[model samples]
Target: MTRRHTTRSSVPRTAVRVLLGAAMTWAGISHLTVAREEFRAQVPEFVPLDPDVTVLASGVAEISLGAALVLLVRRQATVGWVAAVFFTAIFPGNIAQWMHHRDGFGLDTDTKRFVRLLFQPVLIAVALWATNALRSRR
Candidate 1:
């Protein structure tokens, strides 16, 4: 009989991953509900889709990705990579929000919006690290 060995992430990584997932899920719900208008501020004018539609679609995406992160323990690395890519893909919206000085989610000031931009990379890194995507398997 052949046995398969599975690797588990450290406690801190697991905690972070779960927390990130929960946060994403909550944000997704907000996008579809109370924070719909706030989320619209993040959609760039150049985007082909309407701002509301974009926000809704991204919300669905976030919900799915967030669920995957929490449920797909065996595929954490893959989920992490996907989450990182999603963060990268949405980065332009952050830039647009900052440049246009859109007021949403308490990011009224340019400094606040610009400062918020700095956190995207950190989220990407956290997703990767929490999923063990940044580690090499021996």
Candidate 2:
């Protein structure tokens, strides 16, 4: 069996990747289980589907993206790009939460919810950085 090479330069990137991957996994689980209702609270009322189904689908996507980040080193850039897009796609949910003044999972106040919405961009940056997608091309 062949082992994947670990470059010294990638240590920090790898750590961030692991954190992103774990976050996705945790969010995925929350969507499916303990925090499912909380996730539903984030669903934009404009979206037509039953909130449960949307939550389930998003949960599955999170798990898949999370697994890809953790397992597909060779495809990290692609995973990262997808991760970025995934976070972008979900931004509306954050917006909805803020607009509706919904509360859940430690974001029990309008200020907390608004502040939480700001973190989506940070997550995107972390994804890109973790995959080195933002590094200068050789």
Task: Provide the TM-score for each candidate, comma-separated.
Answer: 0.92, 0.91
Q: For candidate 2, write residues 1-138 as lDDT tens digits.
A: 998888997999998898889889888988999989889988999889998999999999999999889999888988999999999999999999889888877888899998998899999999998998777333
The superposed Cα distance between candidate 2 and the true structure at residue 120, in angstroms, equals 0.7
Q: How much does candidate 1 score in TM-score?
A: 0.92
Residue 95 lDDT (model 1): 97
lDDT for each residue of candidate 1 in 15-59, tens digit (9 for 90 to 100)? 999999999989998989999999999999999998999999999
Runs of candidate 1 with Cα error greater than 4 angstroms are 1-9, 136-138
Estimate the lDDT of model 1.
0.93
Q: What residue runs in model 2 are displaced by over 4 Å at the alpha carbon?
A: 1-7, 136-138
Model 1: weakest 10-residue lDDT segment is 4-13
Every candidate's CA RMSD? 2.3, 2.6
